[model samples]
Target: MYTEHPGSCSTTGAIGLERTRFFPRQLITPDDLIQDQIYFRDKLRRHNRLLHGWGVVCGARIKPGTGECEIVIEPGYILGPYGDEIYIDQEVTVNLCQQGTDGNAISPCSDMTDPWCSNIRVDRQSNKPYYLAVRYAECQTRPVRVVGTSCGCNEIECEYSRIRDSYAIKLLSELPSTYADPMPQPNLDDVARCTPDHACPACPTEPWVILADITLGAGSKVTKEGIDCFAHRRHVVSFANYYYLCKSTTLPVVRSIFPGNGINLNNDQALLREWAQRPLLKITFDREMAMPKLSEPDAWLRFWQLRSDDNLTVVRRIFLALSPENPPATDESGFTATYQLRAGAQELFQSRFLIQIRATADTITDTTTPPNLLDADFSGTKLSSEQLNQVWNVTDQTTLSIEILNNLSTTDATLPSGDRAAGGQFHSWFAVLG
Candidate 1:
């Protein structure tokens, strides 16, 4: 049998006697451990409360003779609010001051002739204070009148009104670097594979067949809105070359060994040389006349290629030009002109590929002035490698047709009325076997 003692060993054995004689320890009970935990928890709570406290002040004021009021805020040693919650990064600060009509200092409360609001708060990052001031006024309240008539025929009237509008501040996170700095834009000049020279092709590396060369004789007249001026041409290609230029034996192939009979390499050499003579198309905008108006008229030059089956491919380009005269009035009214390129129904390139002139006018007030010349050069490669590949992959021997549609419309209500004459040359090319 074992008996328990409060402070000593109850067993009367040599082992118990040895333990009691050699080792001594202080006893801690469950209650004591629980008390220690509570003490530490309270200390942590007090420390946290000291670190985070109400650190922002808000102020409000009315704008004199106006219905609007501005709210001011000052931050203390704490992070500013992001949305409804506070953020840790404290890089921003608010500045506010009260100024008189002549830009002189004025008392925030009494010296201010106009309503004013001022407040201060500290920033969490620098642990510095910031001040803010805002003007406020009521915008949408109407006065109510009360009238009383006494028995003696005397009337009394009273009006009731008060400024009850208020404004609050909301902070949003800054945009990420990826959005702040975007990728470089593509340029038409960089992508254009063809030029205007009829003697030389723009892309000498690629085989080309001359399809059509139509000289716009006298230039078409464009006057009314939504009206279209057009030029059209027809072309055709052989079936074998259209379907199997790469696989056809008639086209030369580089052989590893010369045949014992000897082979003529002129055809193969000619095929490669044909790259220099690839076909090209060019359009020129010549004379333009305008009737001075408050607004400017927009014009579009559209080019389309059609196959025998009526499949249509659209080509787009943008041209930008500035006014040549540099008038003072024109300077006050900034001007911009652009011609954009599209594929089928989608617009792929815009301001980047434009042919920019020295001057751009959004509104044409002087119609009598001579029109500025706008020129743009384009190549099949401008369609992008993927788009060009899609065109080359067509299997059918189709009648290649081309058309240019010129249109003009008003972009603004005050656009000037105008009659413009435009003339240009059109050239189309196809891949062919030499």
Candidate 2:
């Protein structure tokens, strides 16, 4: 229903006039009125989704909550997965440390044992990762008092208004709450797609973009210690290209955790920049060693794509030549010897895309030895557009191959010329508009 093009007017042809026609003296029932109104409403939503894509269009910012495990969502507008519009015209609060689905307070689990988290829809406490996302919803409003019939069935019914267009802020797990499923893999196309819990109240299958990756320290109970003290969140990104907000790899954007945990991700992948009603994605990072004993990697890339669906940020074709934040490292020869540089792993994507390769340091110095030209030296060349196109332009390519020749220095004459390469670059591209 979402994949069709918006160029044709027939998209709303699901209902014909013949279905709504009433002959002279024909009576129109309330059912007909409701049906026609709902049909047109749904059509309009689908049309919006088909044309403009989805995500925050204006001012819905996140801020810290006054209570424990609470987050405040500022007023804003957004287009949901089904193209439904969610308008948060006022501020609202959501408790991240939720233990129930009814939006009611429940005593935190003391031991924190939840086995059926994945089988049925249940929230679990984990020290790992959870995503903060939002969706569209609505409820009863502006009640009109009406006299009850002889029967008391109208106690909960006969409401004047039933508005159904509001935003829902929630914390969700990308993976099912169960242990049977393997680790969820990052979508090569859409970062929001995941092996989610089908029964999730947060609409697992709906088009909801991630805002951030939230982590809770072990044994955090809302009834006891506060989430403000235990929860941590972050949003990370690398250089997508010079056109991006953060053009340089050396200084990729990093929105670290704050008191309110307001950071945006997965929403700025579109050509249009964020102003108001902006959706967001949050993440966390744990840097690793670049080389066996060498220092951490200093360069990386934040590759991405621009498409019709702003809510869906696909995994662009990336060349994994290094771990810009912290590439993996290993020692081959031994101590006091040249550290073996392991070239980055081959990157794979399911598209024909361009890549950026950056390398630095024309020479290497071994201070351990006395002057006079020591042993090892490193050599590298910055990647050119033509060079990247040689592999990226291939009509049938998924995996990116890395070259170890010039990027590495075969030093340590004392040890055999071990295969060494230092090509660590950043991984994914999820830009944030300042």
Candidate 3:
């Protein structure tokens, strides 16, 4: 029954439940859970190994035009019972060229046109090292080995690609230890828990493990589905309703020109000046209620403003209008035409300083543009530049009455007929603006 701010009634604020409730799902589906488990288990192993003390870690950069963001290893790192092979187990690294505005690589990695395509080798037939492109199945997460045969007395039959003329091996200082004696492959699960610092007791030494760090840019776009997912998770603990103990919190202090709630305009300019510098306006509503919906036509706002000096008193009122049936050609500004400043005195203005048009509802068949807002109270008073200066000289204290008139074409539209039901799209606020 308690409410925080009287304005908490805004549409965006009214989302919590008043009580707890539960629902049952129709059937059970465990396929997704199983897949998630498998992916988590395998992915852990694929990135967890640190084999030959010299294996290379490959990943992509994802920074801005000059920054890197993605760093995924291809087939990750390799582990073998036999000592590393000279060139057979050699690890090659390449960068994936980002597509440019025209869809071509600005700086193509010619040596590895497509890591997604085939394995490229370094050609050392000449004094300088160069890479030669070869054909192979599209490279995925698995590494593919190529073999070639040598034909001569001096050359034993070699099973590998000679694209590099076998000269690239010279670039590597220490050769892969011989693995003629083999040990049983470790269980993939246990291997996942094994750290790179210690691949095995028998394996020569741990391989070089490369780790990449990246930061995402602020321009990243997020979809509504993503927000909904977060909300769904939060809802687990914030089940509908089941209200918590309500306590009043001190509201921000704000200065009010029209003093008191019932009927008092201590319209003293000196008093008003002191109130204005209080930083914030504090109002105690007594209790906390769910946040309110501002869009509700019956919803209205009221506040008072006093000059910084001890000389003026101004009261402000606000209202909302609906574009029912056929909307107006142009939206009306302000909420009412006639503002009853005092009982029996009604001033009609084409505009009200307080009324504002926000949005319009779609019409069934009317092609005319709808009136988004209709402000009326400010219509008549030509308080032009000079008239507004005509402050109500309060020689004697007087009670001021205010009534706002809503004259939009839709003011008479049909509304539900009960107090509990929504009233017509009309509301009123009154204050003694001294």
For each candidate, what is the lDDT? 0.23, 0.37, 0.23
Between candidates 2 and 3, the one scoring higher on lDDT is: 2
Residues 336-408 of candidate 2 have per-residue lDDT tens digits of 2111113121221122122222333422222222211112211112333453444334333233333311221
1-434 per-residue lDDT for model 1 (tens digits): 01111111121122211212223575766444445444453344233223321112221111111111121222212211110112112222222122333221221222223455433331222212112211111122333555453334212343324323222122112222221122244364754556555232121111111111111111111112211111111111113334534322121111111110112223465532432232111221222223232122223222223222334333333221222332113122222222222232222211011111111232222233243322222231223334433333333323322221111111121111111212221112222122
Evaluated at residue 282, the lDDT of candidate 1 is 22
> Which candidate comes out best when scored by TM-score?
2
Error of 3 at 341 (Å): 16
**lDDT tens digits, residues 1-434, model 3?**
11111111111222232222224863435443344443443333233322222222221111222222111222222221112211222323322223222221211212343357443332222222111111111111222242453343221442222222111111211222321112134365875575667534442332211122122223322112211111101011112346787443232111121222222222555644443332111211112211222223332322222222223233333222322332222213211111112211121111222222111231111111321121112211222222222222222222222211122112221211112211111121122244
Point out where model 1 deviates above 4 Å: 1-128, 133-144, 149-157, 161-418, 424-434
lDDT computed for candidate 1: 0.23
Q: Judging by lDDT against the true structure, name the best candidate.
A: 2
Ranking by lDDT: 2, 3, 1
- Each prediction's total of clashing residue pairs, residues at least 3 apart in sequence or on different chains, is 31, 26, 64
Stretches of candidate 2 off by over 4 Å are 1-19, 99-126, 142-148, 151-161, 175-204, 217-434
- Candidate 3, residue 184: the lDDT equals 39
